[model samples]
Target: MIVAIAHSRAQLGISAPAVRIETHLTNGLPAFNLVGLPETAVRESKERVRSAILSSGFEFPSRRITVNLAPGDLPKEGTRYDLAIALGILAASGQIPHAPLGDFEAVAELALTGELRGVRGVMPAARACQQASRSLIVAPDNVLEATRVRGVQVLPAATLSALCGHLKQTQRLAWAAPAPPYAHSNLAGQPDLAEVRGQYFAKRALEIAAAGGHNILLYGPPGTGKTMLATRLAHLLAPLDDEQAYEVAAIHSIAGLHRAPGQWLVPPFRAPHHTSSAPALVGGGSTPRPGEASLAHHGILFLDELPEFGRRVLDVLREPLEIGRVTIARAAGTVDFPARFQLVAAMNPCPCGYHGDPGASCRCTPEQVRHYHSRVSGPLLDRIDIQIEVARERNWLSSTVTAQLESSASVRARALAARARQWARQGKINHHLSVSELSLHAPLDRPTEKFLAHAFEHYRLNPRTYHRLMKLARTIADVADCPAIAQDHLSEALALRRLEVAPAWPAGMKH
Candidate 1:
């Protein structure tokens, strides 16, 4: 009897869990069996592995061969285990020594002709291997991605024969150096604020939203440039730092975005259509992959035509809005994905898309208008920090002084300055400040407090809404470079709350 062991990683959401492959060969009928709760892809690798071994000119053991992946209930998936299994079989059959394989963790798929193929989602596994101080052996195709990590030894193998030769000291593998970091794109090329032609007040709201990391909602007539505002907002936000860039890129790599690792410094932007289901928005499946929300981690999630989305689908965002992460539960286990993304949703005032238009006449009755607005619930709206009504620009094309309008670069500068102040003072963005943290960081003067109280009573504001209003005022103060929350700042913040009450229908409305 002979036994050989090797190690690799298994895909579990955005995580990489260690898996051990133990191979045993004994004198019995020539039968091969793989045990350990492997999914279909893993089970099918048996045929691929045997073919690869024979094609690589390695001896195939004829005795009973039983391979067990340790921790039987982990439920392994994918063909990432194939390379480890092949190496294990070679070791157990005395074709290769075991001591040489101890320092490295390998993962790759095997072609029937013995070539090593790249597998998806290798970033997280590479990160795990680096953290554990183990060398990582990857297929030549995956070497580009594996080089994203530093301080870890990464080697590329082209086929089973090449890997066996390296293990037997008959050949040498070249070490992969970390790739150079990519520079951020020029912010000037981004959509400029001047392109919108008008809506200066809405532009101010976007600035505040970017400054404080706040979620916003835009409601207006069709062709009012709501979607354009969301896109420009992406440019105004700050680029991801090194740590955040790695995290965001890691998520994308797992999702198979396959962007060159260095070029992902810009924040991500995800715009899911209204017809998307809850699983596609918030994430769900037997193996629970990240949805659009998590895919936009540390960036932006824009949902245009918000009212057209199903009420249930829109409501799924409530959890991630309150918490920075989403927990997806499955029979296998629960996995959490980062979802600290700013939401920017847009919708028409009513089904007609012009219920309150100045130029166009309304054709829909009050009931229909109310029903269209009712698709988005009040609680969800309350979670949004800023709400603005985007008015239709009468001189959208006629206005000729667009060159004087502020560019995205200028607005982004102001937003970044404000964000810098908040980070310097409180160590976080204003929107993330807790109640106690706000009290310590943003204190209201007596007169400002009185003004806020009156507005709270008049608007029937909930506790959360009132606090968010305070946070908004704090952010506005930061943008204006004010040292205190003055009455003017509070008043401006109050005026920016555009959705206090849903518009009354043309017909006499009923509560």
Candidate 2:
């Protein structure tokens, strides 16, 4: 008899529907075959499944066993299908009953000893099972992530024997429940805002950036603590809500980064290297996986040494930054991943890395400086909301200016209050405000209106830049604890836009 069990595979994002797993036994050449668009990882799972079943004391039937992951046209990837395939084979060979397995979705990896190892994207898989009104069975290691999805029965198994025992009614597995202490308190080695000295303007900009979910560009000479400030900004963000935490954990789980059995309540901070490829940064392959941007959803993606990144790689971010999602199309199918990330990039003024520093002389020629600046396209720069130059502190490395700075806890308190105000008034963050909505929410005063009109034509700002200006203004208002946008807010907003002022290029020229 042929045995088929239902399981799922994550394509681009966690919320997508799952691929159906079908196992069939046919009398043929006693060969094992996998159909559907299986990637290299899925194909390799056949070996692991076989080894796991034999090691777990199950007989490998000497019949033609064909495993099919349907929809046959959709591409399947990763080690997530190992346990599902093993279970399907066991059921097909009459070693395990198919009755208990039919009502649940099972996903896990298997070791040679039949130990059920955790696979990536288990959270999303559990969510899909719950939405389809089926119970979710996952590896014991993935129980923490799967439990994040509420209203779902999460059955965690540590080994193949445990799973078989549960299915055969010999023993019952404990159902996964919501993890208590949703807010994370332990920030191991997390940077603190209090440690940063001076640069109050930069600190304020960081605060505003956190408040509005805006992208920030910190351009200055080296050793100005740009990276240090960016690292600490995550601490100021409000803890992720239960739903958002689940989404984040799912992405981390799918990316194989969620190894611990606890909550990931804090916002994620992903700082990819400058040399990261477009695929790794944006996510693409034969079988699609979430990239750095997708993993950083509802969080921060910090790119230090921004200009050093490949021009093409940097350019790939424009689409996801604007739309809050990334889609990868292959011959098998197209998959979309959520990429609503706050871009926090930092760089020096020029290749010599001291173009604007008062403490150090710039070694680069004018042409070299211009070329270095040109590496970052004007279009990408326009998307950034806060652009501020940080000058090196006067005391080189010796002076210790000791004044109490606001703690991240206090800053986060203010930030959440500000965020609540914005959400209450506009139904979203300032960065998401539409043009007509901005006219009402961030209504410029007479003088500010005139300034923007003149600046738009004189500076030849694009519509996106125009909207970014208003968004920055709204953020400024939010930081000031003001109910309405004010002239000072508009002025502060324009100040940040001055980072776009650089050596002029010809019309239509981009990075």
lDDT tens digits by residue: candidate 2, 1-511: 5866757665455664677678888887888887774457656787788888998888888899888887765556657777778888888788888776678777787887889888777778877788888887788888887876777788888888888888878888787776655646454566788778887788888888889988998878888899989888888888777777777777787777872544377778899999899999998876677899988888899999998999899999998998998898887567888899999999888887887566689888878887787788887887888888777877634455545667777777787888998999989988888789888888767887887788667766666677888888888888888876777787788777656434332122222
* TM-scores for every candidate against the unseen true structure: 0.94, 0.88
Point out where model 1 deviates above 4 Å: 460-463, 501-511
lDDT by residue (tens digit), candidate 1, 1-511: 8889988888777778888999999998999888885557656899899999999999889989998888787867758889999999999998988986778898899999999998877888898999988888898888877777656688889999988998999998777877776667577556778787778888999999999999998888889889998888888899888778777777776676776653568898899999999989988777667888888899999999998899999898998998977888988778888888999999888878898888897788878887887888887887788888898877767647454888888899999999999999999999999999999988988888998888778766556677878899999999999978988888777766767633332322111
> For candidate 2, what is the TM-score?
0.88
Q: What are the Cα lDDT values of the candidates?
A: 0.84, 0.79
What lDDT is reached at residue 226 by model 1? 93
* Candidate with the greatest TM-score versus the true structure: 1
TM-score attained by model 1: 0.94
Q: Which stretches of candidate 2 lie over 4 Å from their true place?
A: 1-12, 16-34, 37-46, 63-67, 171-178, 184-189, 259-263, 395-401, 451-464, 500-511
